[model samples]
Target: MKANRFVTVLIVLVFLVGGLFAQGQVERKAVEVKVLAGVTGGKDDTENALFEKEMEKATGLNITWEKPPSGYDQVLMQKLGAGEVYDLLYLNQFQMYALANQGALTDLTSRIAASSVYSENVDPDELAKIQMNGKYYAGFNKLEVFPLVNVNKAITDKVGINLNTLNTLEDYYQMLKKVKNYMENTVGRKPYYPFFTYMPDIWDLQPWFSSAGVRRGVFKDASGKKYAPFVQAQAKPVWEWLAKLYREGLMDPASFTGKTGDMRNKMWQSQEIVMDVDWAAWTGLYNNNAMTAGTYPHTVNVVGLPGTKSPSGTFMLEQGGASLWAIPANAKHPDEAFKIIEYMATKEGGLLLSAGIEGYDYVIQDGKLAFTEVGLAHAKDHGAPFPISTQFDLGVLGTMNPGVLESVAIGKRADVEVAPMGYADGELDARKYYDIMSKWMTDCIMGKMSADAAMRGAENELRINSLID
Candidate 1:
């Protein structure tokens, strides 16, 4: 009787285990999610096929990537305007802001608040940048400062200029003047390369004026009025300062243009430019090139060219994210959409998206993120494992090309200015704003119109549009 009872008990236990295993195998419906992927050079369907397949397997979600041929902002705006809102929308702050006010995207305040992934993984400072009116509408991108002053020490020695004496606009002018004279006298009229390059865009010009405490896009004045630098009273002196450099033949008028490779060739390739205010990634790359080719004798020295003497510690990347992903108010499968986001915040999703399939695409080398033979080959064919959907892996960045970290110039307040909370009132037109400002800037710098004239005209336009007062 004891033997019979024990056998029966064992059989019951096996049945219970079988039932639990079968329950776990219940298949979930594969949710089809349409996403506007603006971050990746997701240039073509073929380019992202492998990535899409990998993501689908990893997340148990189907995704369709809609990539615009060109002009990401314009394309995203167009889709929203035409009432073709996709399930997932990825956009920069301005683009997101434009739609966010219209009640288009979902308010993710509560969602992020409840999410353990957001609270635990995401940095507090990063979370702060993505908030509007104390609510998070989008996920924050990792912030990185690229305000660098890469000076060729060899050239500076030849010109008899010391970077240690650099302070205020007057000091900067002297440095440029010394270099300008050296180039003309020693090298002849090849071209005067003043370390000039704008990252992200020409509009994000913080490296040049941050020291004097000027923020790009929108900064606050002494009166606490939020305004763009071009229209601000404080910016006048800075403009005058730059104008002085231009007029003195230290700054080349021809260098300021839409053309590419003009500044790079002079600064990096030709080795003619003396001082460059740019990002570390490019500077580090240049350093590598110089080292390899024996072109530049000395390493490109880092310059602290922030306008103010107080030194604003390390400058923050104000607009760090390209576009914060948002779900449209008129979306189906909202649950699935949130699921995707939640999964993305997980370590599994982050690795899959950033480094690709570990054994297949990448592998750990010395406990650091390293690409395998497979990853290198794929990178050569397609773009490397840059997960545009998220911040890739912060860990990978620590092990990344080392140029990115070396490019960071601490103690410079790049574009330190004040900006009032929220968007400019009324319908915001980014195209008109950028167009007018770009032309005005080039005009002012190139001498087509005076800075005062350009500012006055721009102020009137911004005021009319209710962008500023």
Candidate 2:
């Protein structure tokens, strides 16, 4: 009887231990990953909360997202400076390069190599573009796109100018002049500025530089020496051309001091400007906004221009910087955080990021995705308008706002060369380069200095600041 009691007691102990082991496994599986995201899933707290729930369900892990709507760059620096720990953080390509140089980010080189999700979804060439000094410190959030010329075709039609024929610098100049004349005289709209280019950082001047056979940003010669193309003699004519536009009242004075928000408002809402340079994705947005305002397709029809031809006969368009997600060096759950990043590069994750929550933003009907009323209103983009996954099919998302497809298609043209701005290799200080160049460019365009003087002043400042040479 004692033997029987001893055996029963041993069996009871075994069962109890097994139950506890299973409970421990469950607890370990429920790890909560904290993220300080700046690029995606931070627009609305309620929406982000739902997004978090969806991400949690997909990854089988708990997630905490802290996304501040404004001043994200400053906030990111402050958080890292304070030694705050987060499993994941969102950053642009430049920020990734800067942080990687500082050793503040985890070296993701091996992690990405081992991840089958990355291999299957992201292109190797794409990864190569974002590498910092031969090592990857972050994963891509979205495919980088280029900004192109967006013109109000309705106004162009009124001027009797065909957008397809606009290939040379003189062509655009005459077109802008005609647009100004027609809008002021026929439409009776006073102060009808025809062209708008944001002078802050001298944004969207790539096309004009291409016309002079000069690519903007820092470049290396065959001898491995660095040089900036814009401050050089070849870029003089483009600078002079811009100053001429400002002098002629064809360019808005606001371009010298106004923000991008102000530019957008002038383009779409008030229709004060007939032409401006903007992102390809914004082609659809401009039309979508006009559609909401009940003036689309006829009164506010917008079209994308592949920009003026270079001397080599190719249109050089500058691609925007990549948006990335990185793991901080001090992150507690890097493995789980990388899992989330990997998921974002997957087809399923791409759908979530682009199309938004399934039930709330869309519904699957008859084995196909159908956008709900909310989804239609949502405009089919939560964060990434264009997903980074190679395996992802955007056709499943259905049609986008009008003009978007055409605008995006410009980069795919046979004669177009889409490249990123200089300092893309991340060896130079891009911020300093932009500030000095913009200041001088603004001084020249606003008639404070001659174009030659501006270029000389810029070259001197860039050399002194160690941005060039």
Candidate 3:
């Protein structure tokens, strides 16, 4: 009878442990993570649904992707201002820093230090780039691409210009003149302007300024004194060059007032502008769009030039700031949300982000990724064109857009200096600096004020705003 009682008690203990295991599985699966995305998603509901499903399956957490149709920046600000809770939020580097300053973001320093996946997949330098006061608050979304000079080779070719031979600001100016003359006289497009720049924030000027070794934004010397390159004497020639373009009608007057969409249209669709400083991705995108319009290579072959040499005798390209993912301080599932962030820093996660959902986006034919018609149409990048994972194989994503490989290779050149926009060790408010510089610089470029006067005004305003010491 005692032996029988022992067997019954043993069965009861087994049942209790099994029940607890089942409950744990259910709880793990029940964890919900809501993400508010700003940079990516919005392809369509179908694609968004597929992406969420795949992410959920991979991370083993229920993920809700909240990607606004438009005005994402405004939406982001509104939601955060109103104290709306979200597990994860997508932000640019500036937003990350701004929020970090407000203590709105969770400090991920300890968590990231403890993560093996991050150590294996993410570059330490990249992590260093996003740290605030030596503490991590976010993880990188993608490797930033730089803006450079993109010229329509077809237009340049018509003018008998060899893009390879162009190496100075004067060379670019001459090339633009030739294109402008050809478009007006030969192509019969009256008053043809060959260049465009968004002057509101003084966007797309880094390539031109790099010619004079003027780096954009705030920086410090070895003695730790803050200074802005644009307000220095070295920047005068660069300003004068732009004024020359504006005065000579080589630059579009609408550049000061037009949106980036207008610039893109002039670059690819209208083919009115033969040259402009734009993102490296735009080099490929230009070719791809032209190809879609059936005017590629021969008529609209857009190619990237590493711009004129800096004083250091190297091509200087400024990287766009980082796109990142961060968890809010009020997140309910901080630990679970971090699991997603950690997973994203893995090879498997990189594959999903780059190649899209397996079987849906691609199929294994002969042990290789064979993209479907849908995948072929979309070009396979959900958010990260270059995944943050060091272990990721880019070849798995298949062919890139035309002109992309050539443009991307420019960053790897030994003669090139690919630098980020200077931030004075994260003490600078980029938005304020941009506004102050834009106000004064527009006057200079538009001939309303002398370059020296504009620089003086910008410098004073910058000092008042504490953007520079």
Candidate 4:
């Protein structure tokens, strides 16, 4: 009787174990998703991986990532035009407007409202950026505009100039002259250029112009007409000032066509440049390599750009949030995509995507977040996996770090202030501005044409494109 009773218990235990295994497998749903994203360095990679991992776990769905090799916007356009459907799409300001105008993207306002996770995580201001015609179409992970000027402390010290004392554009010019003189006399090398302003890209040029009390390119007038600030009378002084920098050899001539990678390498490896304006993401790359090679000088620091007041008696345009994430009209699993977006926006998700898995990747010590040396080394060398939302999407969930805010305060010139350029509307015609402005600005910066001529040409082009009445 005892032997028979023991046999019955063993059989029940075996069945129970099998049932649990089957249940686990059943809960996991197998699905495929294609995502379009712009390629950046570490943060983007880490964020993309984290989003995929978390969403897979929560929804029991397997996601396949299909990222394009070239320009994400162009690739997305081509794919959509070809009738290719993706599970999720990453949209920037231009692309979002273009796609929405073409009816190529889904209305996400309803989906966002329905998701408890999204409702809890998203901020109002952030939500405003993604809205078009009173409907929300995109979500963001962070909501701050971060532009940091990285300076080589060694170069400044070698010239005996105080970095802190340099505030105005004139002060900046004098310091650059000193550095250039030092390079010529002592090092027998080109003293690092004073400013490596990227003229080919309007996004880059906007901030510098913004510092000079001019909000040019994409802005509006009092009558609500779309106006290019660079062409206005107020912009004349600013352009003339930059033209002087070019003529005086304070700024690099090659920056007109230099790619971002070329500029990054020149600053990081060669240390040939004294200062370069870049986003905060570059900081991670700098910290990772600076200590290992001991190439970066200890005195180097990051700060904001100088700002000036406009003649109109207002400050330069105040910048706002960067990029955001949008789901494509053809996304296969919209529901699952929203879940992933929500997770990354939440505190729990932000930590995971930005920092990584807690015990394995980082540890908290003394109420301060500290990475183990090994963890830091790992992040520096191998790079961490982050969710896609955190990288492309801004203002969805995570709060800006104090450092970013401080940089903004520093960059704001006393006379220059930030102003809103108006939120993006779902209009395909808006994208025409990019093609027109980029061409005209490039011509103006290269000295191929006069600023006045370029402005007139741009106006004519806008008229031709129907952007102006």
Measured by TM-score, the strongest candidate is 2
Error of 2 at 390 (Å): 2.7
- How far is 146's C-alpha from truth in model 2 (Å)? 2.1
TM for candidate 2 is: 0.87
* Candidate 1 wrong stretches, greater than 4 Å: 1-30, 41-47, 57-85, 141-150, 157-167, 188-204, 219-226, 288-321, 343-354, 365-368, 377-402, 409-428, 438-454
lDDT of all the models against the reference? 0.58, 0.87, 0.86, 0.58
Residue 332 lDDT, candidate 1, scale 0-100:
68
lDDT per residue (tens digit) for residues 1-469 in model 2:
9999999999999999999999997787468798888757734777789889888999988888788778999998898888888899999888887888788899999999999999999978678778776889999888778899999998899789999999988899999999899889999998888889998877899977888778777776767667899999988988998998999999999998899988888888888998889999888889989999998877888899988899899999888988999998988899999999998999888888889998888899997889988777767777787888988887888877889889988987889888778773677788788899999999998889999999999999988976777
Which tens-of-lDDT digit does each residue in 1-469 have in candidate 1? 9999999999999999998877665432235677776654222455467666766676677776566667887887777788784777766777667667878878888888888767666656556666765776666332333444566666777677776666566777778777777777787855674645432245435544555555556543467465666567766666666666667666645456634356555665666566656544555556655655566456343233333332464332223333356778776666666666665555555565445555556677798667776665444112223332233454562353324343433422344322222233323455666666666666666567788987787788767765665
RMSD of each: 10.5, 6.4, 7.4, 8.7
Clashes of each: 12, 0, 0, 26
The positional error of residue 459 in candidate 2, measured at the CA in angstroms, is 0.6
Candidate 3 — which residues are off by over 4 angstroms?
1-30, 220-225, 425-427
Looking at candidate 3, what is the lDDT of residue 70? 85
Task: Tell me which of candidates 1 and 4 scores higher on TM-score.
Answer: 1
- Candidate 4 per-residue C-alpha lDDT over 1-469 given as tens digits, one digit per residue, 9 for 90 to 100: 9999999999999999999988776555335655555532123456446545655665566765555656777787788889887766666666677677777777888877887666666655556656777787776644444445556566677788776665555666687788877876788875446667666645455545554465534444466566555566656555666666777777777777788777666666666667776654454454335545675445333334433333454434434434556787777778777665676566565555455544545666675456665445445221112232323332321233323334544433455444434332433254567678668866766667777777788878877775653
**What does candidate 1 score on TM?**
0.74
